[model samples]
Target: MADLDGDFESAESGASETYPQQCSALRKNGHVMLKGHACKIVEMSTSKTGKHGHAKVHLTGIDIFSGSKHEDICPSTHNMDVPNVCRKEYQLNNIDDGYMSLMDENGEQREDLKVPANDLGREITKKFDNGETFNVTVLKAVGNEAVIGIKCQTS
Candidate 1:
């Protein structure tokens, strides 16, 4: 139907763009999608050609949020999808009921978000004091937001 086609076209146009990258192009400390999980590549190795006649790439990474190790192997020429990730800094405003209220540099308050489960997050949870300013890293990707790290702002 014409209406269905129009709606499909609009949805397709609104989708985010992703580029295919060769396994060899991936590097340590880079982000990659492995097994449908966004992971941070912590280690990578390339193997010489085997009887199959292709260099193989082995990657080991941890889930960005869950911290679970993920490992995979593929031919060096294989292509993979890379996720769009962005980091922004926010100031800590308050913490209550396991949620953090943050404000950007422009002083705009963001919706209270759950604290991350990393070491930095734990530190914030135990040491938060109202009115203390902190520099916090917010990881944004694919409509997800998370606090990755936090450091007290030095006077």
Candidate 2:
């Protein structure tokens, strides 16, 4: 007999990560779950019904945090997972060992995010080294979050 004693309860077990949405109702620039990634729909088109099949909706999306592309096709009447995505801004506080310290408007601090290893990271580092105060935009979805943008604080 196989053992099954491991506790697999997740911290967000009580929260629903995604909601069901009809494929045909999803629009471009909306949020979607493609291949297990939370993405923003960049392009969408519906193809006419085939010989004995229903109409298909083709989707092309970009992963909001990772900037990766994902695509999929499904019958227009089928249901698809639409992730609950949220964006929040925080004041940049510090950076150390590739991790960043950020403070929210209420002064709550968060230090769990890593500096992206892409062009954005380089830009962030440069701005920080130059002593430019800025706000970081963090995108959260599907139990994951990341710093997606930065904006200088204006007078």
Question: Relative to the true structure, how large is the alpha-carbon lDDT of every model?
Answer: 0.80, 0.92
Residue-level lDDT of model 2, residues 100-153, one tens digit each, is 999999999989998889989999999989998999899888889888898888
Candidate 2 colliding pairs: none
Q: Compared with the true structure, what per-residue lDDT tens digits does model 1 show for residues 1-155?
A: 35554433333446563457899999999988888778899999999999867999999988776779989998999998777888889877777777878888888998668887678777887667545557788887655777788777888
* Deviation from native of the Cα of residue 97 in model 1, angstroms: 2.6
Please report the candidate that would top lDDT against the real structure: 2
Number of the top-ranking candidate, with TM-score as the measure: 2
Give the CA lDDT, 0 to 100, for residue 101 in model 1: 81
